[model samples]
Target: MVITEERIEQALRTLAPVMRRTPMVASRALSDSCGHDVWLKCENLQRTGSFKPRGAYLRIAGLSDEQRARGVVAASAGNHAQGVAWSATTLGIASRVYMPIGASLPKIAATRAYGAEVVLEGEYIDESLTAAHVYAEETGAELIHPFDHEDIVTGQATVGVEICDQMPAVGTVLVPLGGGGLLAGVATAIKLRRPEVRVIGVQAAEAAAWPASLDAGAPVKLATMNTMADGIAVAMPGAVPFAQVSELVDEVVTVSEDAISRALLLLLERAKLIVEPAGATAVAALMEHTDLRLDGQVCAVLSGGNVDPLLLTHITTHGLQAAGRYLTVSVNVPDRPGGLSALLELLRDQGASVVDVIHSRVAGELRLGEVQVTVSLETRGPEHQVALRRALVDAGYLAGE
Candidate 1:
C-alpha cells in the first residue's frame, strides 16, 4: 500500500508515546547567511539519536503474533540497527542486526545493549543487507527493509507533521536523502498538507544516487558508494521512496565533504548541537546553494547524531584548517637551541598561540648550519595567519606553506 497523508497521521498518533517530539528551533546563523528565516528540525536528539525508531517501532508493531514469534532481522550501518534492536526489545521479540564490519563501535555496542544479537558482516551496508536477507530466509524471520516499506515511510512522515505544526509559515523544507525514505515521508506530509511549501532533498556528493536515478527516471544502483556521511550513503534509492520523492520533492542537490564538515562544525559551535555528517547535509546545502531564493521560513532537518569520536576529531581539525583558524608553516632557522626559543618569542609577541613545533636537522633543503622547524599555530583567522607569516618572513626566515 502507498503511504498517504491519512496513514501518516495515523502513524504519528500511534508512535507519539513511543517517540520524542524533537524540537524545531530557529537558526539565526543560517537565517543571516541565507537571508531568510531558517529553522532546524533537531531529530538528532530523537530517541536512539535519530528518526529510525519511529519507523522500526511501527513496522514491528504491525507484524502478526506468528511473525513476532518468528523474530525479525535487519541490516544497517548503525542508526537503524539500534532502532530495530530497541523496538524489538521493547516488544519482547527476538531480533538480529547485521552491520558493516567498519560501523562505529559505539553504535554496535548500543545495538547489543538493546538486547539484539549483533552480526558484523561485509564491508558496506549492502553487503550486510545481503547477509540479513540470507539469515531471514534460513531462519524464517521477518526481514525489515530500512527505507523501502510503506509502513516505514508512514512512520517517518511524523517528522513532517511536527514540522508543519511547529512552523506554520515554513516556505521550504530541506532533508538529507539516503534511500529517500525520510525525504519521501516528509515531502508527502508537507506537500499534501501545505501544497505551497517546497521540499528539497540533499545528498552527499560522494555517495549520491538520487540525482542519477532521477535523471534515469528510475531507481538506479551505484556500483560503489564511499562517503564519511555513512548514515545517508545508500548505493541506490528505495523503489517506494523513489516514487514518493519523484512525485513530491521539488529539488535535489549535492554537497561536498568539505561543506559537510563545515556544517557539522558550525552546528556544534554556533547551535551547540552535535550532528553527524549526514544530519548536517541540509545545513551544508543551505550554505553551499547560493541560487536558492528562500524568502519565508525554511526548515532543515538534522537527521542523526551517531558519529564516531575519532571521525569527529578529524572533521573538527579539518574544519579549523578550512576556516583559517589553524595555521602550519615550515621555517629555516639556526641549529642552536636559542633559535627555537627566539622563534617562539616572536610568535608569542605576534599573538599567535603555538600548538606544536617540530625541529628537524635533515639537510634536504637546509643549509650547512641551518635547521628546518615546522610550527603549528592557532590564529584568529586568515588575516592573523597572513600577518604572522609576513612577520616571520620579515625576520629573515624562509617560511613555507
Candidate 2:
C-alpha cells in the first residue's frame, strides 16, 4: 500500500498530543564543516529516545479490538523494541518484544520496564524477527514489523512533515537508512509536498544493503553484517520500504565506521548531544562526502540515542583515535626506576596528558639495559600528536611504533 502525505498528516494529528515534536536546531559547527546551512533533526530526544515510537504507536493504535486483546509482538535490536513496548503499554495492549542476544542492556531493561515481556534470542535482528514471527503465529498476536508496513511508513513520514513545516527553506534532507522505513517515509512526504527538495539516505558501509538492492532491482541479503552501529545493521532491506525509497529517494550513500564514530563524537562534544552511531550516519555522510552539493539549508536527522554506557565509552575512544586526539607511543629508556619517570616528564612538557603508562624490560625489541615505556596520551589534535612524537624522537629516545 502506498503511503500518502494525507495519511502522514492524519498520523501527525493522532500523534500530535502524544509524541514530542522533536526540534530542528541549527548546527553551526556542522554548517561550517560541510559548507552548508546545517540543521539537526533531534529525534534522539524523542520519547523512548528514538523515532521508532512514532510508527510503533500508529501501528498499535490502528489494530482492531480483537487484535489488541490478542496482544502485539515485535523484533528489534533496541530502539524498536522500546518503541513497541511503550506504545503497547500506553494503549493497554500486552506486548512481547524479541531482541538479539547482544542487544544493548539498557534497551532491554527499558523495554521490560515499559511493561512488555522481553525475549532474548538470536545473534542479530533477523534471527530475533524469526522468533517473533513464530511466537505471533502460535499465540495469534499481531506481528508489527519494524519498517515494512504502510501504517509504520505513514507514521514515520510525520518527521518529514514537521521538517517541511519547521524549515520551509530546507533544500536537502539526509536520513539514515536501516530497513528504509524512515528514508521511505520521509522522502515520500517531503517529495509529495515539495518535490524540489533533495532527499538522501545514508547507511553504514559495513551493513549497507540498500545500494546492492537498488542495483539488483530487488531486496538483497548480506552474508554477514558487523558494525558498531547495531541499530542500522539490518542484513536485508524490507521490500515495502524499498519500493518507496526507489521511487522517492534521490540518492543513497554509505559512511565508514570511523566516520560514524567521529560524527558521534562531534555531536557529543560540539553539539552537546549524545547520539548513537546509527543515528549519526547522516552527519557522517555529510562530513565524509565533500562532493555533496549541500549549499542550501541541509538537515540531517539524528534518528536515535539509545546507546549503552559501556559501548559509549568504547565508541568515544574510537572517535578520539579517528580524530587524532589520542596517541599511543613507546619509547626505549634505561632499565631503571627513573627511566619511566623521565619519559612522563617529557610527555608533560609536550602538553600531552598521559592516560596510561606501562614499563616493560623483557621485550624482544629492547636491549638488556633498556626498558620499553609505552604511554597512552590525550592531545589536543593532530598537530599536538605530531609535535609530541617529534619531541620524543629528538630527545635521543628510541620512539618506536
Q: TM-score each candidate.
A: 0.96, 0.97
Those runs of model 1 whose alpha carbons end farther than 4 Å from true positions after fitting are 399-401
What is the C-alpha lDDT profile of model 2 across 1-401, one tens digit per residue? Answer: 39875788789889998899999888999899887899999999999999999999999999999999999999998899999999999999999999999887899999999989999999878889999999999999999999999999988999999999999999999999999999999998998999999999999999999999999999999998878988888888888899999988899999999999999999999999999999999999988998986637999999999899999999999999999988898778988778778888888898999899887778667777898888899999999888887888788785445
Candidate 1 local lDDT, residue 297: 89
Per-residue lDDT tens digits for candidate 1, residues 1-401, read 27876788789788978899999878899999898999999999998899999888999999999999999999998999999999999999999999999888999999999989999999888889999999999999999989999999988999999999999999999999999989999998898889899999999999999999999999998888778899999999999999999988899999988889889999999999999999999999999889975658899999999989998999888778877788998888888769889999999999999899888998476788888899999988889988888898889885445
Please give the range of 10 consecutive residues that has the lowest summed lDDT in model 2.
Answer: 392-401
Error of 1 at 341 (Å): 2.7
The models' CA-based lDDT, in order, is 0.91, 0.91
* Clashes per model (N, Cα, C within 3 A): 0, 0
lDDT for predicted candidate 1 compared with the true structure: 0.91
Highest TM-score, which number?
A: 2
Cα error of candidate 1 at position 261, Å: 1.0
